[model samples]
Target: MSHHFDYPSDETLDISDAYCFAGAGDAHGPRTVFGMNTSPFGAPTWNATGYYELKIDTDGDYIEDITYRATFPIGSDGTQHVQVEQLTGAAARDRTATGMIITPPNAPIGQVVECQGGITLFAGERLDPFYNFIPYPVATTTALKDGTFPDFPAAGPASDSFANTGVRSLVLEVPVKITGREPVHFWATTAYFDKGHNTWIQVQRAGKPNMTTFFDFANGTAKIADYNGTAPTIDLVGRPAHPATDPATGIWGQVRDNIAAVVEAGGTYDQLPHAFPTPRAYGAWAADRLLPNVVKFIPGTVALWDPWCDIQNGKGIIEDIASNIIKMIVNQDFSSGLTPGPVLDYFPYLSTPPPPAS
Candidate 1:
């Protein structure tokens, strides 16, 4: 991750952009929360500071209507003090008006650990809510032993592996009204000011805000949001696929089933690349149906989706599970708008051209 930003439409996605937030499972992992420590991911850049904002435009006209900010402790241990604000237009640009600490009323016990100056801080371990390689001897592997992929999710129930992680998680959740919709396909990135260098570096935490890194799948590939950072380009494992033209008619079922096959091979990996990213369709499918769109009648709402962290609001899982269900129903017909449930929606663009090293 570098301090520079990638502009897809000669455009960049950041807290300054419309509709965004930052999220991670188990904010108190030793390097990461349990089950997510597989990689020392989301490490802050040099002179990392703890101030971030969630910017969003409920309607994609490109005008940011909401701004939510989180301020973290300025030293090591990521103190996790946070703040939220409700602002409009130029008012938000002013640190004074736009920045106000509000209590996260009724929020879970650890949801907002503290609130100072409109910043409600919640920094602690929540379960590794994002569904990763769990629920099977191999990810994507189904109990349907006949060789055909299972008609539905193979996992008997959602389970927390409790994988130990060393990194402390940092994030905040803004209301849907702030995001402009109850649900939307949003993206996230982090910036840290290296006081020593008197500069700030950037990191695009892969997918949408509050979403687990593993949920950005679409057609066996994911669309990583461009970032403003100074870290090396991260690696994405598994096969990559081209973007799809329409959600109702794509080649995703084959992708999921195929991925299931890959996971089944060597039931428990004894070699390299055992764990891989989930197919991209999972994220895109959910995004498409839940986020507002001109394609179908019901905009900004999915008919069915029951996935959440129960702690910090696992927005990504809500989208991914809907996508997986639709995949099973389609039986490999990526295109058939008759979704069993809403599927994930993919990002309009993926990975940004990384900035130069410090």
Candidate 2:
């Protein structure tokens, strides 16, 4: 799962996005759920003031064809009100496009609005569903520095770093008919209306869990912000050349080098014998799989993110995403060894927010 605080503190927008698409058996009749959670969850007021959007690319062009956006406005009673909109075609691609409102603007947090076209929307504080071993980042950094992979048991009984914490969440579930049966790619963004610039400034963009946090650990604030500001298409090609002396300006190069450093240090060449000859060769191959970091889901099928699963369609809220990602990067059966807590089985499926600390 994305830590949501991956960027520099000044540009911090703590929207960690996760998504899943369930089969026809669901009461919603095959729906795709997009979940966004923000940090420092239970406050006197909602922390996420800006709007969040789920971008869906239906035609496989890596460009969004449909967008479901949620905006929050604080009411006089100090509760946050949610308004959801559906944008399509040019509007979906354009940040300034408002499209059409699908849900009633007066709907407050915890209230489920059944919009036209069978869309269900909810916005409120919820227990963050992301679970990871507390020291995973430290372990990864250690691997980069000393070539030692994390030993789950040695980390002192897997502990969930996000347990009991909460997040301001915007969850939207749309019927499969809206996205059709074709495979679609999904990513999310957090943006604020910049009064000075007279345009929306996207502060964060997330798709695959932990892509920015894990692979781009070596990059500085500017590079991290640039990664969040851009689209998946740019990710696939690569970022522009850096002004610095380092020629590894492209995202692929950076990702490859980072992974290669760990593989070379750990002496894990035997793990991927087919990538052959050198750790860099394996790194390059792995980079291809990790780039263009969007979640792909074929509607009407259950979504899962297991590395060994033949089809990793999409990421479920409770999926062990951290473990799967670690296993992929190292080409080993690594695990976070921390299990996610239980969540509700119905609409707005996340568990209720934990009570505020005394």
Q: What is the overall TM-score of model 2 with all chains considered together?
A: 0.88
CA RMSD, predictions in order = 14.9, 3.9
Displacement of the residue 214 alpha carbon in candidate 2, Å? 1.3
Residues 228-280, model 1: lDDT tens digits: 23111111122234322222312223333343443344232122222223333
Residue 344, candidate 2: Cα error in Å is 1.5
lDDT of 2 by residue, 1-358 (tens): 6645474343325666557656224554577787667654344444345667889999999899988887777778766677788999999988777888888757777777888787888877788887876577557745644445655466666788789887777777778779887888988887777898788778777887777777553352225767777888876454324312223446776776677767666667456433445766666666666767788988777778764333478888888887777765676667666778988888788889888789
Whole-model lDDT values for every prediction: 0.30, 0.70
Best by lDDT: 2
lDDT of 1: 0.30
Best by TM-score: 2
TM-score, one value per model = 0.38, 0.88
Name the regions of candidate 1 deviating beyond 4 angstroms: 1-48, 74-80, 84-98, 101-121, 134-186, 194-200, 205-358
Where does candidate 2 stray beyond 4 Å?
A: 7-12, 23-29, 40-44, 47-49, 76-78, 142-154, 217-222, 239-249, 272-275, 308-310
